[model samples]
Target: MAEETDHESKTEAATERRVREAIEKGDIPFSREAPVFASTLGLLIALALFARGQASQLARDFAPLLDDPRGFALETGGDAMLLLSRVALAAGRFLLPILLILAVCSLTASLLQNLPRFVLDRIQPKWSRVSPMAGLSRIFGTSGQVEFLKSLVKFLSVSVVALLLLRSERTRAVNAMFVDPSQLPELILTVSIRLVSAVAIATIVIVAGDLVWARLRWQRSLRMSRQDIKDEHKQTEGDPSVKARLRSLAQDRARNRMLANVDRATVVIANPTHFAVALRYEPSENPAPLVLAKGQDLIALRIRAIAEEKGIAVIEDKPLARSLYDAVQVDQTIPAEFYRAVAQILFFLFARAR
Candidate 1:
């Protein structure tokens, strides 16, 4: 029975840890579109990088095959197949490397922007997931409204760009039909440039919309209420009362340990109302002074009582006492700026001790 209880306790602890990790992750679901977009962009970049070399190699490899059908068949299939296969393999050797590097880069880029967190609850079998009414509601949701606006903006931007590009290319577009055949390439080049520029403009608009969406989505994900955090802590760390008791016990023990050092202190500085700080200086062992104990209010009063019972000197300097209590913590030396004032107090104490 004891062994079974221990096992159950361990299982409960594991469940709580898992819940805490999920809460810290902000419960964001993975979006498939971002990864797909990243991979596509990476592939485009990879293709652009090798465009010239790959285009030239392809031309060289295919030009001879295009000229003779028998030679093409023989090179591709028959007696010359081995040599043709080796050539083809050699020509395509860099393709896999390019693809793998781009894929990894795309995955890394996507992850760096926002790590996809899987939440089973989001995709659970519910009426909402499959309902037409639910779908319509989402389509009319704030995010859905933004999506509609973005689509409208994209359409308008693309139409404007297309119209501008067409207008700019109108003269060359018309001349292409009547001009000499030698001018055909120039007209084609002009139209291609216009189309590419228009497409580039459209891409920029889409990217801007994506940036806005990413920011908004992250903001929404990071929102958490005070009660939600409290509930999450309860779920993750067990009851609030138990944790509070543990913390209180720990603090009490710490205070006792600090009071135990009261007899060892060289001096005690008091605010005479709500603050007490004790310092211990040993010239033989410590180069600088150290705080032996410090406390405020009830703890402060307790420290003062312990000091009185131990016959430790109690010095009252309102500003110096307050500053020491605020700025320097227990077991730390006072700062250099207060050295002169501290020296005066120490000198008086040493003279009185003598």
Candidate 2:
């Protein structure tokens, strides 16, 4: 039960690296509704722009065939084949713009939701996808159920909207029936465009809502377990114990270097056991005394021992040692606040040497 609880608890949000890895694996947020919405919009626009022209062209092209089929020299096989070819060419040219519009709409819709990316892994076939159990699970899964429900709702809603719009346009449609025969096509085209536009706008609202929900669900699905977070941190930043060992090794090398410089120090001021600061001054080259090294506790003992071994003076002035250790750093000149005390010590050492 304890193990189960631990496994169930995925409270941590996924890291950026995790999300990026998922994208590389082609596991990304997407909404099927967006493409549907885009295609509908594209179709509506294409129809609005080209419908009347195409209708007129179709009427003109086929008018002769419809009015007087016997006028064609169809008794010859060559003439019949030529007529069929011309019809095919005309139909292809007429539909090409709408097809192009739909393709562009689908591509643009996908690009807006997710930046273009190609992952070979997504195209590779997986055994799980072909498994009977997997298929059954997908059909019964929470996501599948939700998708089905959403489709049903969309179909019902669109149908109701379309019906209501058609009812509203009933009077105009009836009046168009009595209009001049040539004008009837234009009237029907106008009403059809308006109805499609209304339906497309309504579908856009549904698609927008689905997109927001899908994104939230995608993020939630990517949430990390506590152990997963820990593993990623280790992978990115290295193990804590290993890092601590490296830090300790670096500190030891720096301390050895600092102790070696203590041999050049003119004087060492000590807090006896807790702190030590070593000072060096060159009258011709240095404007003020410089701290050669400063340390506390174990490091302080090592600094004092090095000073004694090098025959450098070691003085126990608690207040001055603490002040210098606090205010000065290794290889830096003592600050003005500590100048008087440090200068007196340097002067006394010089006098003794003389």
Candidate 3:
């Protein structure tokens, strides 16, 4: 039963369950990309933009270097070793900010998702890792199909944006060659902004779609089978056989206890077919006589067994036994109306004893 119950629990725990739980709790993320991915993407974009800005500044600053012989000499390098060092230092300085930003953003993303949970399952080796056949299968799997579609869409989207930008600025770009250089920066910024915005919007939409897909999958995984619910109910309520055994044990214990006290009972009254009750009197203390034991069917047989074992007289009083069983509980005094009827039975018992 335990094993069956465990299997049922496992079956009910599908990926969809997690998605449903997340949705119910409002714990689902806005996009499929974890904080780390979002931060990394943001950092990469920021860095790229910074790099472009820095390159522009460098071009504007060093624009006059080409006109001056000494400045040109300094830019080109007089000392071979020093020139290489300078160029390396300049490259590092230009790129370092973006690299640092990306690293920080990546860390921030990881932090948002709760850093370094370090689940061993993620690091474990599997047949898929070593199997070329499996790798090929996965590549042609549903996941691969989705990836292929995504790539195709991305390529088309980027191409469309690129064409639009080039088409819109074609005349200005050609005309800017002889025009004031100020117009050139404005044009470049406008084109870059439009392209970046389009790409960013596309990326957001794709990521959002992926998140939705994941949520759907999670919900599907959580679905419970009919068998699973039934098994869980059995596990929680206990097995039918065990419950029956427990009930039998309880009856046996009660019978034993009642039989042990039967020798002290004053009278055993019976409905003959259905109910039986035993009553005892302690006139020295109790205000009224109390019922010693009561039961129906097999329990009535058990009451008779105890009474016969103890040599207590069992009277086949059908009406009195049934009334007492219905109106009174074990260890309680009989009601007033039943008292007069019971007195007559006690008088008869005493007359027989004499």
Candidate 4:
């Protein structure tokens, strides 16, 4: 009841992240009926291809014993052991091919549905696996009820197929009873193959339906509540407060780095106290003057103070300072349009030094 209530609360379809996580955790939709259907089909194929030859070989091996049971003596332990080994070998030959076919078909069926992955969580022991309540809930749950209904339908359908095949072959079956015992294996193989082929055809519809059902059930199980989506978003994108703090910290670090580059400036263009643009120029190193730092107001005053302390030239040019501060970025070249204005400042400072 609690589980059902929880399931009902998940009204929204799961997000891509939710689906991906579910798959990583080894939660995937798999239809048990797919493998059953494949094995049943494999059984039919085995009966058609191999059963006839094996059964004939088996019958031939056992014919002498069946024809004259009293003539073959089992008087000693050695005689009994010899007979037993022969019987075992003949039985193995008849059954081994069919068993192999079933095994291959079952494996292929499973692989077609889901890729193989080793998930430790699936193998780990859990309390729910041993709990009586859990076991009972699983046995009587929606999935269990559906499985029961499907199995009942499959059994009835297979039975009907067998009955119909038997009805059609009644004459041949009766005639085989009076025919040579050696020919009985062939007669039985024909009927078995026909019955399995009919049943296999019937199972095709059931398997296709079950595959669709399993996928829908799995998707429904992965559905999320509105709260669940919000929580998942937070976990994926992180807390808003924390993101803001991080952005602030990054800005502070960049500002400090820009301020530290003030001492390397060849010229500091200042709009008195309103703006400052510190530039470094070397014709050999770069084609244009690089803006080392730019700031406004208090930061402008700080840049001017740092320029005085480092003995770098500071020229008050309101138009150039404001334009460079707006147009240039730290650690980037000034535009060609500002080249003449900045070059005039550089020439004046160099001439004074000379």
After superposition on all C-alphas, the RMSD of every candidate to the true structure, in Å, is 13.2, 4.0, 6.8, 3.4
Identify the runs in model 3 with alpha carbons over 4 angstroms from their true place. 1-118, 171-190, 221-225, 228-264, 280-292, 315-320, 323-354
For each candidate in turn, the TM-score is: 0.42, 0.81, 0.65, 0.84
Q: Per-residue alpha-carbon lDDT of model 3 for 1-354, expressed as tens digits?
A: 884565456555434444454455544433235443465466557645685676566446444543453653444335666655656766676668777776777677656544344445546888888899888866897656766776677678778877887898789778879975544555665666666666666566666666676556544445566675666567768888889999999978977786667668888999876888988877895767788888899888878888888878899988888889999987789989987888888889889989
lDDT of 4 by residue, 215-253 (tens): 999999899999899899889999888899999999999
- Tens-place lDDT per residue, model 1, 1-354, is 884454334422223444466556455334334554466555555555663455455555655554554664453356587657857775676466567756886688667766666766756788987899889978997768977876787678778878888897788688778865444544554465456555554666466557667665644544454455566679767997998999999998988899999889888889997898898878896776788899889988888898899999999888888888889977788888778887788889999999
RMSD of 1: 13.2
Least lDDT summed over 10 consecutive residues: which range in candidate 4?
187-196
Tens digits of per-residue lDDT for model 2 on 1-354? Answer: 784576468778899999999999888999999988898888888888987798677666666776778888887889989889878776776678888999999989999999988899988899888999988878888678888888888898889888998899889888876765556657777877887788887777779888998998888788889899999999999999999999999998988899889999989999989999998888776788888899999999999999999899999999999988888888899888888888888788889999
Q: Using TM-score as the measure, what is the rank order of every candidate, best first? A: 4, 2, 3, 1
Model 3 RMSD, rounded to 1 decimal:
6.8
